[model samples]
Target: MKLIAKWVLSASALLFVAYVYNGVEVRSFATAMGAALVIGLLNAVVRPVLVVLTLPVTVLTLGLFLFVINALMFWAASALLDGFVVRSFLAALIGSLLYTAIGMVIDSALERLLVKK
Candidate 1:
């Protein structure tokens, strides 16, 4: 139940990102849902490996390089999906930041709503 809620909210967040930023475009709600799932999968499966491989650069940049990795993941998801488009690396960066912020809110809300105290 919680997972489904998170997925739905994540999709909505994607649509919100598209609506707010001209650089990122989501074609429809279904497309946004698909893109959200792909992004989640990439973040779950690939992002850790990327973080490990880029540890040196990440450390050198004092953790700021993680933002680049996040943008890459965001861009990669757009590349894999037909209906979701990120215009450029800069767009990916801004879109990812917005999505991440929305995701954090979703997570916090879900935790409060679903977890028993």
Candidate 2:
């Protein structure tokens, strides 16, 4: 149940990102959910490998390079989903940051609400 809630929250965050960025478009709520799933999977499976590979750069950049990895993952998710589109790397980066912020806030709120129950 909590997992489902988290997934829905993620999808909602993606929708918010699409809403805010002119260069990003989500065809529908369903497409946003699909995009969220792809992003979750890529983050789960691919992001760790990329993180390890780029550890030196990450260290050199003082951890800021993780944002680059996140943008790449966001763009990759867009490529995998039919109706979710990011027009450029810049758009992807902005979308990624926005999604992260939105997701963090939603997750924290949900955690607090669930904890009270």
Candidate 3:
């Protein structure tokens, strides 16, 4: 299904981040998948609430503060998962940014490919 493909794309992005950054790591494919699920859930459920609560700062910063929220969610997922490790907050921030960039690219590509089918 589309959701499964999206999850796989996210996990692939996480794996790519782990490969690119020494400070971020995943013990296995399963761990990466788990991390993807946790990150997705947090983004879906918690991120909106945090965004609403921080709307003033977000508006003040021209939406830059959303990056901080994304980093926090990434770090929280690392803390919750035993096999996924983020060595520092900076690593989490970078990883979060990379994952977003990579996921967006992959999603757009997949969307185009699926539409042509």
lDDT of 1: 0.97
Lowest lDDT sum, 10 consecutive residues, model 3, at: 4-13
Tell me each candidate's TM-score. Answer: 0.97, 0.97, 0.96
Report lDDT (Cα) of residue 105, candidate 1. 95
After superposing all C-alphas onto the true structure, candidate 2 shows an RMSD in angstroms of 0.7
| Rank ordering of all candidates by lDDT, starting from the highest | 1, 3, 2
Error of 3 at 46 (Å): 0.3
How far out, in Å, is residue 55 in model 1?
Answer: 0.3
lDDT of 2 at 30: 96
lDDT of 3: 0.94
Ranking by TM-score: 1, 2, 3
For model 2, residues 4-116, the per-residue Cα lDDT tens digits are 99999899888888887888999999999999999999999999999999999999999999999999999999998899999999999999999989988988998899999
Residue 19 displacement in candidate 1 (angstroms): 0.4
- State the number of backbone clashes in model 1: 0
TM-score winner between 1 and 3, please give it.
Answer: 1
**Alpha carbon lDDT at 8, candidate 3:** 87
Clashing residue pairs for model 2: none
Off by over 4 Å in 3: none
Top candidate by lDDT: 1
